[model samples]
Target: MASTTLRLPGLGWALLSLLLAALFSSCCLASASPVMNGPPTTWLSAPVPAEDTAQLRVFLPSPEARDQFLWRLAGAGVSADLTTLGFCSSRCVDLLVPEVDRQAVEAALPADAVLRTAERNLGGRLRAERDRLAGDAHRTDFSGVTRASDFFEDFRTYAQIEAFMDSLLAAYPEALSGFVSGRTFEGRPIRSMVLSVGGNSTVVDAGRRSIHLQAGQHAREWLSPPTLLYILSGFLEETSGSANLPLRDLLSQFDIYITPVVNVDGYLHTWKGDRLWRKNRRVNSGSNFLGVDLNRNWGPNSTWCTEGSSTFPGSDVYCGTEAFSEPETQAMSQLLDSLPNVALAIDYHTYGPMILYPLQHTYDPAEGDDAAHFDHLATVMADAIRAVHGQEYEPMPGSQLYPHSGGLIDYAYYTRRIPAFTVELRGDGFIVPPSNILESGEENYRGLIDILPLL
Candidate 1:
């Protein structure tokens, strides 16, 4: 038997060839494209090349020494990103420096100033970790009622958070109250919730002193909102008779106001576009960078463009043109002003397990009269937190953490004269693994419970 040969028409053959060429081109492009999961791509495209950078944990005896070294680094035209702030003299700061200038940085340091390698190939590591976490997040099931695990399993997107909030309100209508405080710069509503026995009716109770709790001021701290949600969940349980009587008694006396995510625009950006976007999405005039660190935009004692903040738009700690320039900050400040009595306030952040009080602008305590009281409160809260996870959370003045000019805790205490504190939750930096969420939530809840009596 002889096999017959097949032939196609000229036009058909040309079309087939074109299709094959297109397929080959597509594959080539896919292979050539860089992997883009992880920290904001904008960060990698910063002035210094990310591949040639190394993250160093510099240990110094004092904050002054660290500042002096940083000044020297800046003078040498070396770019350094401050990743973590500490409270004591022997504080270790994580700084990303170009590999080319690593030797110069080491040489510029004093004899006692030691540098330890934290991360090499910073962009690559961040991308790999992000991709891994994203993959794990895809495996989560969000079908029925969200369990305690669901909130802590992985970082939720903005839509997921909104959905969770809706479910929460629907589940416990009497114990939780929800509202829109104000709109963000990007037109997103800044949602808030009140935990009280009467829910919505709590607003009418003029005698009730309110306690405000806020998180997500910096968008990259994905763990902040969930931790607050965890605390909220405990409050709900107390109202439902599942928790202890003491908790119920404490919760009933005051309305607990919680803003889960303050930087709504930036939080969305972290979920959809970049995993490490930190500031609110506010466009700056004549600058390619777009955002202002909400934490640095508060007023009444705002030392803008000073230490712990930057005037340059590209800097991570970029303070806005003026105090309360960002709409998110404006909305929050207004809310605080409108409340008849805000006895206690807490601004939650992440990456450092510390409880910080006022006077962030300077090392000196501005509220000298209330200094002892603040310390006692912080100590009690810290002890409560440590009981759960055995994690030692340093309780100190915010200024000891770093020389931050404008901060929420400072504004709340100084301008409003309300007792406020900043709780910096600890994990693997900003991106805490889902496994640690529940423990963090539980520990923080214990701390809050201890704090209520004082409030």
Candidate 2:
């Protein structure tokens, strides 16, 4: 824990880490190129009005195409966001390009790169998505959850989300205990609910292992909170009614900790300010940027701001001024340290049907995380998810998706020695349809419970 705290390394260690990285992390050289610091990874924040932006799903033919596109973007001075919390693949990524620059971005790409506009008007899509998710949020019988299908029919505001948790707490007092993890940058309480058959202390007294499921590190991924809430509702249900035997067994023996939203300020901002906001509400000193990307503000790892993140305050993937610079991440890391025994940690995200495991900052295999065991668990989880709705979820290392430094999963895995993972939910646009929330949660519930017996 001492070594893993949110403190920068001394010059000696920092240089040593680089040397060792140069020696063995060659596999991730392309991804780890500090691309974010320069104009290549920077999308220049787009030139057009923010609301006029459109999303492009670019299919790169090869690594060369990807590189050329980045350089082309830089040379053309065209803004093409290739990756971020944005969905990415071995040769494909989704980008948000300005309406005027679409043709320029398209021309910058190689002939082989297949670029398709995912959303014609990102702002209009979000506005409509908000309206749709706001449907029938008020119900006559909203006193308490009579059945597991009580809520999640629509997206909820921060207040509504908290109210939903309170309802669950009141309904299952014996099984649920609510606590404030900490305050966010905006002074909002970051809350969590622990689910155990008898209660939290009982789980501790029994020496039960805990698995934490959290979502909403990025603000605009609106489906994440409710999806996680869906999972929470499923697990906290009476075991007698659940045909999910593994979940029953899990509840009988393990503690389930659920945090529906980690970036409270960002989420609140999404509701009140920009519907597409991505970072926490932190006004950087001497800069116009008003937030720091919480996902990239984690850890003091060797890869801190090297790749997959930016030093610029305006960048979407900005890593903050330093590791754990934001209160949200500090709160999250505090929560991680408070857990007596964490068997696994999974941070959920939106717009991807993928299960990602750690050693995320590098392409190298983890020395002690038992790659085979991790693979097996991820494989089974993916299968279970697919079985539910005939939708596929690829299980792979996060680095293979894209090198992300200072990521929460990397911090949880490399520092705490916990088996950490990230699940990207439903690879649709961030403005996911409301109807899909319950179904995605159900499928993910299957994926999660399937691995409990094995854990």
Which tens-of-lDDT digit does each residue in 1-455 have in candidate 1? 11011222222222232233225433212212342111111111122225555667788877667755654454443333322222223255666566666776787687998787766666665566567667544432454333454656667877777777887888887778789998899999999988776435435467778888999998878889988988887677656754567666777778888999999998887766355677888888876667888887888643543445555455566677888888999988888877767899899988678888877766778565787788889999999999998988888888776667668888888767777888989763554457677888889999988978886
* Clashing residue pairs for model 2: 351-427, 352-427
- The global C-alpha lDDT for each of the candidates, from Candidate 1 onward, is 0.69, 0.69
What does candidate 2's lDDT look like per residue over 1-455, in tens digits?
Answer: 01111222222222232233335443223433554322233332221124677788887876456655655554553333322226556566676665666766777778778878787787677667667656654443454652355566667778788878888888777777888888898799999878886444334544777777789999888888888887777776746355556556667676777889999988877776366677788888876656787888888656676666656555577678788988888988888777767788888987677888877776777666466677889999999999999888888887777667777788887666766778888856777666787788889888887888787
Over all chains combined, what TM-score does candidate 2 have?
A: 0.85
Alpha carbon lDDT at 382, candidate 1: 93
lDDT of model 2 at residue 269?
70
Task: Provide the clashing-pair count of each candidate structure.
Answer: 0, 2
Which 10-residue window of candidate 2 scores lowest in summed lDDT?
1-10
